[model samples]
Target: MAEALREQQLCLSRFIRDPHSNPAPPGIEARRLAVYRQLFLGNMQSLLAGSFPVLSATLAQTQWQSLTTEFYACHRCKTPLFTEVAGEWVSYLETRSDLPGWVAELAHYEWIETVLLLSDNADPAHDPEGDLLDGVPLLSSLAMPLAYAWPVSHIGPDQLPLEAPVEPTLLLARRGADQKIHFARLAPLAHALLVSLQQQLLTGREHLDALAQRAGVERGALERQGIALLHGLKAQGVVLGTVRG
Candidate 1:
């Protein structure tokens, strides 16, 4: 009896996971098996649709359904939580060769908004009045720097570009004290400086010096520009403030 039950379970599982290829378990009505298959796949489709509305809108219905079905059959999600399923779908896209070059990047960009909102990192302890140039700058725990080959922020049904631009798009997404996630377009130098701050490998002054050297500019000029940029970021809650040593 135990062996028969195990066989029946395996048969049902296979049929449900890939109904097109697998036969229903013996004595189970085909109509009942069809309902189970639709229910499981439909629920996953809805979840992914909610998580990636933009991506869904970009792809035709047939293409979208095919992609989701492939994901359901081929990918073994690392996480069991439904909240992380979209992340798993993104990972699956990373391995595919048939997808458009921007598909994976766009999917990831969309997924990041949700990831930041759910982050547990609290506001760091710092001095809001501290000098950005003199003190160690503290990046908000929820701040994320993202670089993309395609203009993912601009991509939609109407704005899809076939070729990537020479300069990549750089963006920063940070959760403000108001609990709102805000996004800003970043210049190259600003992006590099913020990355350095996030690494905590140097003081704001040192980072400015390094950036100045890289840009072949006088240190004083870079310092002035960088300070203003830092102030703007602080106001937006991207930079929490400076950490006192």
Candidate 2:
């Protein structure tokens, strides 16, 4: 009896997930199945649209519907939470070949805002008044440095590029004290600097010294400019502050 009930449930789920290909379970009315399919698909679309507003707006009406429908029918979402549906869709898009190559990157770019806003990571113990150059600076747990092949920030209905730029688009996404997510483009050097800071527990001067060696510039020259840049990032809440120790 349990096996039969489980099979029935699977059949119903398959039909709801892909009604076009999977027939309804035996004895279920077509009207009732239609309602179930509509409700499930509608909720999925709404959640995706809310999370990836730019991606939805970039695709045409039929294109958007087809994209959402295919994702709904084919992708087996690993997460049970509705909030994570966008991330699952982004992962799904990465595997798809029919869509534009940039689609996944753009979806990820859009979805990052949702990730930052919903992040539960708390600020680490640090001194907001500590010296940035002398003390090891701490990057906010919520700050992320993203690099993509396509210029995701510029892709929209009116500005889709057929070819990727020679240089990758580098972006820093961070949540401010006001609990709002902010995004900014980063120069290659700046991007490298932020990534180094995030990955290592190093003092600001040490980070800049390494950057200078790699960049083949005089340590004094880079240190002067890098110190100011770090301070600016601190003002923006990207640099949480120096470590307490």
Candidate 3:
């Protein structure tokens, strides 16, 4: 009985994993299978494309179909649910050998925005400590900040960037206190500073000091910038506590 159940699960997974190829049970003819195959493929493709419109627009139709085909083959999402499929699809693309480095980076650039928008985690709406300038942990509300070595911030329908940007592009993604998603380009030092602070590699002061060194700013200027950043964080509703914690 258990073996039969497992086989059933595998059969359904195969249909979902690559609907264009496999369809229903033994009694179902290839023609009948094609009907289901079309629906399955179209549904999944539209859902992903909706979330990644820029990415979809950039690719040729043939390439888009091929890309989705590859995704159907490579990704084995542990959950049976479809809502989380986008996460697995994005994760799959990051390591896919057949895809070019630039395309992988571009997909990730768009994927993160979706991830932030759907994140289930929620930090408090307000910080009671209220010491915005203290040297405590500096974190994005979700603390899953990411950036890329390419300029994917301006990804649009007009065209894909022909060359990678010499400078790194920072991505600040978080659900704001207003319950809306915000994604913005960040300076390299700012990205490094936030990442360092989140990893506890440095305190807030230490991060600002590093940024100051990199940007060739004076200590006083750095302190002022750090204070400003804290106020920004407070406004975003991610301040957890003071350094005394």
User: lDDT values of the candidates?
Assistant: 0.87, 0.92, 0.69
Whole-model alpha-carbon lDDT for candidate 2: 0.92
lDDT by residue for model 3 over 1-245, one digit each (tens)? Answer: 99997987778668756765765556557776677667777788898898778778877889988888777666667877776787777787887787656677777777777777777875444345646454455465554557776667676667567777787677777777566677766666556667766777345676677778877889778778777776666566544554444
Off by over 4 Å in 2: none
Sorted on lDDT, best first, the list reads 2, 1, 3
After TM-score superposition, the amount by which residue 224's alpha carbon in candidate 1 deviates from its true location, in angstroms, is 1.7
What TM-score, over all chains together, does every model reach?
A: 0.91, 0.92, 0.79
Candidate 2 lDDT, 116-233, residue by residue in tens: 9999987879999999999999998999999999999999989988999899999999887788888899988779899999899999999999999999999999999899899998
Off by over 4 Å in 1: 1-7
Please, what's the RMSD in Å of model 2? 1.7
Which residue pairs of candidate 2 clash?
none
lDDT of 2 at 12: 98
In model 3, what are the clashing residue pairs, if there are any?
Answer: none
- Sorted by TM-score, highest first, which candidate order results? 2, 1, 3
